[model samples]
Target: MNEKLRVLVSVDLDGAKARVKTQGHVTLQSIQGLYDVMKRADSLVPGLALELDMTLAEVEPQALEELRGCARSHHLPLQVDPLQRDYRFSILAPTLVALPVAAPMLAAA
Candidate 1:
C-alpha cells in the first residue's frame, strides 16, 4: 500500500492566500508532512490565508484532530473543507450499510 501523501500547494499572484490540496490516506505518520507543507506555504507569503482541500483524501480521526489543534494554536488562518463522513463508529457496527444484494438466479448463471 502506498502510504505516501501527496500535497499540492498554490498561491495567488498577490500572495495573499494559498490553497493546498491533499491526496491519499492521511495517517498519524503523514500528518507531519502535511503540516510542513502548510508551514512552507505560509512562509512564502507572510500572513497568508490558507485553504485546505481534503475531499480527495481519507484522514484518520486522530490525525484530523491533531491537525486542527496545531492550526488553532499556530493561528494558521486555515479553512478546511468539511469531511464527507464521520470516521468514528462502533467497532461492532458495519462500516457500510444498504449494500446491493444480487438476485439468487444471477448467482446460478
Candidate 2:
C-alpha cells in the first residue's frame, strides 16, 4: 500500500489566547498540546508517517532530546530540520532526549 506521510509544520501556534508580541512566544504547554493532537492522529491512523518541524535548531539540545524520547516511546521517528544553512542533518530525536539532561524550551504562554 502506498501510504502518504503526514507532515505538520511549526507554523506559529494556532488560536493562541494571550496577546503576545509575536508568534514566537510559543510555550511548552502549547507544544505539549500539539503532541497531544499528533498522538490522537496516530491513534486514529496507525502507521501514519508523522513529522514535525525542529523549532530550536542547535541551541535547544535538551528540548530536542525530550521530544526525541517522546517520539521513541511512541515508536515514531522524530526529526529536527535545521533552519540555518550551516547545518543540514536528520538526527533522530530519541538520542537527544535520552541524555541525563533536560533542554526545556519555554516562553510566555
Candidate 3:
C-alpha cells in the first residue's frame, strides 16, 4: 500500500522565509512529497532560503538527512521546527507559492 505524509509549505519572498512542515513517517517512498514541495518552492522563488518545520513529523534519521540534503542542494537555510506529533496527507498537485501576494499594495488598499 502507499503511505502519505502531510506537507505544508509556505514561502515569503519579501520576508525571505520559506517553510515546509511535514508529519508522519518520512520513509524513502514517502519522501517524494518533500522533494516535490522543494521543487515547487524553487520554481516559485529560486535561491530562496528555507525555514523547515518538521516538528509535526515522526521522521527517521534518513528523513532528516534527506531534508538536509535538499536544503543544501538548493542553498536554502533550513530551520527544523520541534513540535506537533504525526500525520498522513499527500498531494501530487502543482504547488503555487504566492507569498505575500503584494503586501504593500494590499496594505495600502
Candidate 4:
C-alpha cells in the first residue's frame, strides 16, 4: 500500500460517498488533483495544520472548530475545492463545486 494519502473533496458526506463510488480504480492523475487541492488550501492558509475528508476522523473536534474558525476568519467558502480541473470536467462528471450553466436571455425593449 502506498503511504501517500488519498483525498476526496466534497460539499458533504453524501457527495463524498458519490466520489468513493466512482473510484474503483483510481489513477495517479486523480490522486494528483487531490494533492493539488490540498496544496492550494495550505498555500492559502499557512501555519494551519489541516486534514482532508478521509482524515477527519483523526482530527480533534476542537481543532476542527479552529479550522472552521480559520476558514471563517478568511471569509472563504466552507466547502472544499472539487478535485475537478475545470467546468468541462464537472460537465462530464458532476462535482460539488460545479456551477450551473446559465442560458442567455433575450433583451427586453
Candidate 5:
C-alpha cells in the first residue's frame, strides 16, 4: 500500500459548484496536489466544498488539522467524517485512492 496524498475534484453540471474527495496518508508535507485542486476549483468554480472521508486512513488529528488548514487557506468549505465507513474506492478514481487502505474484509485477520 502506498502512503501518499491524493485529491479529486467533482463539479456540478453547471460548473458553479465543486467539491473534493481525498485519500492516502495526507501527511504535513504532501499537500501540493490537494492545494492545486482547491486552487483550481476556486478559480473555476464559485463555491468549493470538501467531502473528507478519512476513516479507513490511519490519520492522526494533526494530519486532519493540516488538511483543514489547506481548505481554510483556500477559503473553501470543508466537511469531514473521521468515523465515516461507507465508501467504495473505485480503481478508476485514481491510483492513490485505490491503494488499499484496509485489509480485505473477507480475509482473516
Candidate 6:
C-alpha cells in the first residue's frame, strides 16, 4: 500500500534558517515531494540553511541515504534528525583532504 507523504516548511523569524517537518512514510516514490518542498523553502529563504526533521516519519534506509547524498552534492546545509536512538547518523557534510605521499626508500646496494 502507498502511504501519504506530508511535508511542512517553516522559516525562522530572522529568516536565517528554514525547518522542514515530514510525516508519514518516506519512500523512493515520495522523495520528489520532499525535494520539491525543500526547493521551495530554499527559494523562499535563499542562502539560509535547511533543517529536515524526520523524527515522526517512517523513512526507508535507501531514501534517507539518497537525501544525504543529494544534500552533499548540492552543498546544502541540511540537518536531519532521524529519531532512531539505536543508531546515530550525521547530517553534516564530511570534509575531504589530500594526504602528501612520502618519497620511496632506495634499496641498499
Best by lDDT: 6
Predicted candidate 6 versus true structure: per-residue lDDT over 1-109, tens digit per residue: 1278787877884957787887777777687777667766766656667777777677776777787876656542233322211211224321221133379999999
TM-score of 2: 0.36
Please give the CA lDDT of all the candidate structures: 0.59, 0.35, 0.52, 0.34, 0.48, 0.61
- Compared with the true structure, what per-residue lDDT tens digits does model 4 show for residues 14-99? 22222211222223334445434544544443433333333222222333344345434542223343332211111122122213
Q: Model 1 clash pairs?
A: none
Model 1 segments more than 4 A misplaced: 75-109
The prediction achieving the highest TM-score against the true structure is: 6
Better of 3 and 5 by lDDT: 3
Which 10 consecutive positions of candidate 3 have the poorest summed lDDT? Answer: 85-94
Q: Would you give me the overall lDDT of model 6?
A: 0.61
Candidate 6: clashing pairs of residues: none
Report per-prediction Cα RMSD to one decimal: 12.3, 16.1, 17.8, 17.4, 11.5, 15.3
With a 3 Å backbone cut-off (N, CA, C), the pairs that clash in candidate 5 are none
Per-residue lDDT of 1-109 in model 3, one digit per residue for the tens? 1145787887788975577776666665666666667656655665555555665565555556665654444432233222221212222212221122244545454
Model 6 lowest lDDT segment of ten: 81-90
Expressed as tens digits, the lDDT of each residue in 1-109 for candidate 1 is: 2357888887894858777887777787776677667767766766677777776676776666666655555542243312221111111111222223357675465
**Once model 4 is optimally superposed onto the true structure by TM-score, how far is the C-alpha of residue 90 displaced, in angstroms?**
27
- Candidates ranked by lDDT: 6, 1, 3, 5, 2, 4
lDDT of 1: 0.59
Per-residue alpha-carbon lDDT of candidate 2 for residues 35-78, written as tens digits (9 for 90 to 100): 54454444443444445443322213454555566555544233
Cα miss at 92, model 3 (Å)?
A: 23
Q: For candidate 4, what is the lDDT?
A: 0.34
lDDT of 5: 0.48
Candidate 4 is scored at a TM of: 0.27
